[model samples]
Target: MSEYFIAVIIGIVEGLTEYLPISSTGHMILVGNMIGFTGEKASVFEVFIQLGAILAVLILYRDKFMDMLRPEKLKLVNYKENGLSLIHVMAAIVPVMGIGYILHKPIKNHLFSTNTVIIGLLLGSIVMLAAEKFAKQHLIDDIDKITVKQAFLVGLFQILSLWPGFSRSGSTISGGLLLGMSRKSAAEFSFIIAVPLMGVACLYDFLKIWKLLSISDLKFFAAGFAVAFVVAYFSIIWLIRFLNKSSLASFAIYRFILAGVSYYYFFIR
Candidate 1:
């Protein structure tokens, strides 16, 4: 297969799993392995395409982004009084940003293996299943009403996603639910928080690999990025609507099946 074709396949996988309770990185690694695309360049490609996914989030939540910039709403006292503000986002992002930066090298070196990803997928699914079953109370119904305490706690939960298959949205949304947030509210907040977190991570990786990119590589990356953007935009919309009416049991079940398949192929076989 051509590099462009491989790019499209990887992009679709990235978009489909990026926001779902499933892990995008895990899917990418699995696909990359099968296609013989694993290496530093492949890792760089994975991070670059996330920018496309984040673009979908920004476009979907353009109103929230604009609200953060309005002159009247810029005041500290009025922050989040109008709607979800940048400050609230920063609160939820700070913990992960700090920890992620400090452990970036270690995580990249030690946890980027197929076995670790399978374990993360299985363990994270268990956490999601348990949180959905046991979390019965919903203290918050709107993303705007999320308290600082709740935001920080959600950030704390995001730390778990440093592992390959433990998804950022899954950990934070599960944390939000366990901390008394409604499903829709938690999902929305999870989406909002992902914007900045992914943006910085993408930028960092781009800088690291910028020197290695060629004209041919640009064409491939463009194809993947555009495909990821289009698919992720629709995926986010569908997921938000789905969360409004359903539990995450199906996602948890899918994760279990993925983990089993991965373990069989990578270890047992």
Candidate 2:
């Protein structure tokens, strides 16, 4: 297959799985390996295409993004009284930024190996399973009621997502539930937090590999990005609506299946 075709496939996987707690990174890696796209080039492509999904979120939530940028909203009284939602989102992003910055090079160069992805998939599945068990017993009724402390703690949990297959959305959403946010709220926050975090990651990877990218490669990248953005916009909307009525247990089960399949392919086969 042409690199462009591979790009399209990667984009579709990224779009569908990015916000679903199914680990877009894991899917991309597995698919890339399956298609014989490996090593640094594939890795960089995976990170860069995430920009497409992040752009989808920004476009879909333009009003929220605009509100977050208003100067007056940054003031103490206004922020505390009316801007708390955006503020909490900002708070949730800080730890990930700090932690990601500190570990970016190490993660990219060393920790992003296939073995780590497998371990992360298995462990992350267990965490999701645990979160589901907890949610069955303790349900939070509202998303807006999420406290700053809770957001920060969720951000802390998001730190785990730095590992491939840990699923940034999954860790953060599960963390939010554990911290008392409703599933809908937790999932929403996870999507919102992804904007800046994934944006930075894409930009960093793009800059790092800029010299190696040809004009043709750029076209392939753009095609992939467009696919991811279009698909992710709808996926985000659908997931939020679905979570309002459905259980995350299905996702937990899916994760278990992914882990089993990955294990079988990597070890049993």
Reference-based lDDT, residue 229, model 1: 95
Best by TM-score: 1
Candidate 1, residue 138: lDDT:
96
Score candidate 2 by lDDT: 0.80
How high a TM-score does candidate 2 get?
0.91
Q: Could you give candidate 2's per-residue lDDT for residues 1-269 as a string of tens digits?
A: 98788888888999999998888877887777778888767766777778889989988878877876688666656565563466777788899899888887898778666677877877888897788778533355654566677778899999988898899998998887677677788887788788877777778777887777667677888888899988899999999998788766788778778777877887789
lDDT of each: 0.89, 0.80
Clashing pairs in 2: none
Candidate 1 — which residues are off by over 4 angstroms? none
